[model samples]
Target chain A: EAGVAQSPRYKIIEKRQSVAFWCNPISGHATLYWYQQILGQGPKLLIQFQNNGVVDDSQLPKDRFSAERLKGVDSTLKIQPAKLEDSAVYLCASSSNTQGANVLTFGAGSRLTVL
Target chain B: QKEVEQDPGPLSVPEGAIVSLNCTYSNSAFQYFMWYRQYSRKGPELLMYTYSSGNKEDGRFTAQVDKSSKYISLFIRDSQPSDSATYLCASTLYSGAGSYQLTFGKGTKLSVIP
Candidate 1:
């Protein structure tokens, strides 16, 4: 089966600019997640979607970031007016929502650089 | 204190050696534990998963979880060069509702030299 897919393997943008990343999760997977992995740290959850509805997004920066997972198949995470601190790898992962089973399959994240 | 604590080791070892990675958590509510391997420039992949306190073995990897001590470990037997990567320890949230949130450690970098 195909793994989770992310576009723009790498991205570079200036501060205050806007950037968007897309993710296509594995087929049959109902849970999608967006995470930010800063250098020297583990990925932190930005948003989570169970099918088309959001399950959690408490960590998301609502003022500068927004995400959507319409139709419950694909997802997009956008960061507007990117800041220097936003330079990090954005990862998308998916799981089968088997309840008690949350082993995530990750994509080859999109690396972002804010200059 | 952080929910999970891990030593960030750029640990280098020769091939065929045993590597032990560990993490400590303060939340006794964490019932599900996991270890993920992440390559440079890539996302993390689950290497092991275990519930509560016990040991689970798969191939050359062993995952041990001790809820009493709030400690978890991943042991790689006969490590290979390809196994060199960053290992992250994560604990699931208390809610059983589809097992939503996860708190991860800073990750330990391991290098296996051939």
Candidate 2:
């Protein structure tokens, strides 16, 4: 089966600029998530979507970060007025269902560098 | 304390040695435990998973979960250079929603010297 797919393997932008990352989850996956992984840290959940509706976004920095998963198959994460501290890897993951362990399959991730 | 705590180790070991990695969690509600292996510039891949407490072995990898102690462990037997990578431990707790929340550790880096 095809794994999750992410676009723009790497990105570099100046602080205060805006950037967006795209992701395509595996077919038939009903749950999708976006996470941010900083250097020397674990991936932290930014948002989660069940189909086209949002399941959680409590940790998301709404003032600067926004995400959408329209139609439930593809997702986009945007960071406006990016800060130097916002540099990190953006990861996308998906699961077929929410039962039991709900093992997530992840994409290669989009690396961002804010200068 | 963090929900999950792990030693961020660049542990180096000779080939054919036994490697043990562990993580501790403060949340007793966590019932699902998983271990993931990640290579440089690649996303994490699930290596092992166990439900509740007990041990599950696959190939040369063994996963142990002790809910009473709020600890989980992964053991690799006869470790090889190919096994060098970052290992992440994750735990999840069931919620009122159909899904659960997964919390991950900082990950332990392992290097098997040839």
Candidate 3:
């Protein structure tokens, strides 16, 4: 089984610019998550989707960040007018409840650098 | 206090030594405990998972949880250079309606010199 796939492994943009990251979750996985990991900090959940509908996004900054999972398969997270604090790795993870627990498998992540 | 607390150590040790990493969580509702290892520039991978307070061992790694103390630990025995990475401790509630939000520690960086 293929693991979660993410694209644009690295991106560099000036502050106030826009950037977007994509994620393709593992097949048959019903839950997808977007997390932001700043240097020296742990990954913080940005959004979570269960089969295309968002389950949780209280941590997401609505003014500058937006995400979508269409057709319950692929997801995209976009940061508009990015700030310096947005320079971090965008991690995508997927999980299933087959084991009666939430065991997530992560993608390599897209590193963003806001100059 | 943060949900999970860990010592962010750039800890260094010689190979074949034993390593101990720990975390303290504030949420008593977290029923699942996990340890994840992340290599530089790579995403984290699950190293251990356990429910209830006890110990679970796999090969060179062991995970222990004490719900009463709200403390969790991951011990690496005969540590190898390849084991050098950032270790993150996480806790979450059991699966319910497919909603599982994991709270993670800041992570402890470990370096094992060959």
Candidate 4:
């Protein structure tokens, strides 16, 4: 079985510039998630998707961040007019079911450097 | 206060020694506990998971949770260099919709000297 896959393993963007990261989860997994991990901090849940519908995004910075898991498959997380503090690693993960129970398989994160 | 707390230790130990890591959380609602290992430049991988309380063991690793104290622990016996990485403690409630979203602690970095 293949693991979760992500693109642009590392990205560097200027402050206020738009950036997007993509994620392809493990096959047959029904849950997808996006998280942000600032340096010296743990990953924070940014958004979660059950199939194609969003289940939670309470911590997402709605003012600048958005994500979608269209068709219940590959997902994308975007940040527009990004801020300097947005410099962090964006992680993507998946699980076998919506009731993940803390069992997750993660992809190599997209490290975004917002200068 | 942060809902979860953990020491971001750059913990160094010799191979074959037992290693212990821990986390304390404030949310009694968090009933599921997990430990993840992250290698450099790689994403976190689930190492162990426990239910509300008690202990679970897998091979050389053991995970313990104490709901009363809101404390959790992970112990690795006869550790190996491959175990050198960041160990993160995470927990969450049983809410239906957002069950996949986990609350994480800053992972503790462990180095096992050969």
Candidate 5:
């Protein structure tokens, strides 16, 4: 099976600029997640979508970070006015089921660097 | 205290050696324990998953969880250079809305020398 897919393998921008990353989950998967991983740190959940509706976004920096999974298939994460601290790898993951452990399949992340 | 705590070790070991990675969590609600392996510049892949406290083994890897102590571990036997990567420990529980919240520990970087 094809794994989750992400676009713009790498990006660089100055602080206060904006950037967006795209993700395509595995076929038939119903759940999608966006996670941010800083250098040397574990990935942190930025948002989660069950189909097209949001399941969680408590960790997202609403003022600067936004994500949407439209039509319940592909997702886009945007960072406006990016800060130096916002530089990190954006990972996309998907799961077929929500029951039990719900093992996730992840994509090679989109790396972002904010100067 | 952090929800999950792990020592970020750039641990190095030679081939055919035994490697052990561990983590601790403070959340008792976490019912699922998992281990994920992440190569550089890539996303994490599931290495092991265990629900109940005990031991589960798969090929050259063993996963151990102790619910009472809120501890989890992964052991690699006959380690090879291919086993070198960052190991992340994660814990999760049902969080309503048909979703679960997974919390991860700081990954331990392992290097296996052949």
Candidate 6:
């Protein structure tokens, strides 16, 4: 089975600019997640989607970040007016909604650089 | 205090040695524990998963969860150069309806030198 797919593996933009990353989860997977990994830190949850509806996004910086999963398949995470702190790797992951399962399959991730 | 704490070590060990990694958590509600390995510039992949507390071993890797002390450990025996990567410890409540949040430690970097 194909793993989760993310596009624009590397992106460079000036601070205060806008950037968007895309993710295509594995087939039959119902849970999709967006995580940010700053250098020397673990991936932090930015948003989570179960099917087409959001399950959690409390850690998401709403004022500058927005995400959507349309039709419950594909997802997009956008950061507007990016900050220097936004220079990090954006990872997309998916997992089957099997009862009591939490294993997540991840994409290669999109690396972002804010200059 | 953070929900989870891990030592961010660029720990170096000779090949064929034993490696021990650990993380401590503050939430007793986390009943599921996991260890993920991530290479440079790559996303993390699950290496082990444990339900509640106990020891689960897979080949050269062992995962131990002690809910009583809120501490978890991952041990790699006869470590190889291939084992060089960052190991992250994560814990969460059972992934079910209305509760899917995963709390992760900062991650420990391990290198097995040949």
lDDT of 1 by residue, B90-114 (tens): 9887333464677889999999999
Higher lDDT: candidate 2 or 4? 2
Cα error of candidate 1 at position A5, Å: 0.7
Candidate 6 structure quality by residue, lDDT tens digits, B5-106: 999998999999999999999988887899999999898999989986889999999999998999999999999999999999998765456446677899
Compose the digit string of candidate 5's lDDT tens values, residues A1-115. Answer: 8889999999999999999999999999888999999999999999989999999899999999999988999999999989999989999999977468988889999999999
DockQ (CA atoms), all models: 0.65, 0.68, 0.65, 0.70, 0.80, 0.62
Candidate 3 CAPRI assessment class: medium
**Model 2 C-alpha lDDT per residue in residues A29-59, reported as the tens digit of each score:** 9888898999878888899888888888999
Q: Second chain only: TM-score per model?
A: 0.95, 0.96, 0.96, 0.94, 0.98, 0.95
Per-residue lDDT of A65 in model 5? 94
lDDT of 2 at A82: 99
Clashes of each: 0, 0, 0, 0, 0, 0
DockQ of 4: 0.70
Model 3 chain B lDDT-worst window of ten: B92-101
Clashing pairs in 5: none
List the global CA lDDT of all models. 0.90, 0.91, 0.93, 0.90, 0.93, 0.92
* Share of the reference A-B contacts seen in candidate 1: 0.61
Model 6 bad stretches (over 4 Å): B94-99
Instruction: Classify candidate 4 by CAPRI docking class.
Output: medium
Residue ranges of candidate 3 with Cα displaced over 4 Å? B94-96
CA deviation > 4 Å runs, candidate 5: none
